[model samples]
Target: MSKPIRNSTEMTDITRLEQANAMMRLVNQALARNDLAALAALGFCHPHIGELKQQGGFRSSSIAQNTRMITRLRKVGDTHAQ
Candidate 1:
């Protein structure tokens, strides 16, 4: 069997996982709100989800994994037309 991970390494992994989780939450909320600007900002500077897919499952499911942000802006006329 493989040896257990070091405590510090375990903590670092935990922190990375938490950060990825938080980024996912923010990305989902932005998507739900249709706030493309916020999503774009995150997309540009978002933390690197761990290289391991399992380590960053949240990013795998959210738009944060996207390399670019593409969304149509709501025009004033369109809003008034509704």
Candidate 2:
């Protein structure tokens, strides 16, 4: 059997997955409403949004990239909270 992930790593992975899932839901809502402004705020370019529209969903790469942004922004907030 494969080795299990350590607790810290598993928690990080779970957090990232949750962030990605949340981002996916927001993107879908924005897409359904044709909310370009909201999508743009999430770092999606016009061309990229067009492609996402055609695909009917954002790619994993896009989700991960945006999720990383969220993580970075959270870190900044945490630093301020200290």
Evaluated with lDDT, which candidate comes out highest? 2
Measured with C-alpha atoms, the lDDT of residue 79 in candidate 1 is 40
* Candidate 2 RMSD to the real structure: 11.4
Which lDDT tens digits does candidate 2 get at residues 1-82? 5444334544566577677778898998899899999999999999999998999876667767766765675565555545
**Candidate 1 versus the native: TM-score?**
0.46
Number of backbone-clashing residue pairs for each candidate, in the order shown: 0, 0
The reply for model 2, stretches above 4 Å from the true place, is 1-6, 58-82
lDDT of 2 at 4: 41
**Per-residue lDDT value at 27 in model 2:** 92
List candidate 1 segments past 4 Å from native: 1-6, 44-82
Q: Would you estimate the TM-scores of all the predictions?
A: 0.46, 0.62
Compared with the true structure, all predictions reach lDDT values of 0.48, 0.76
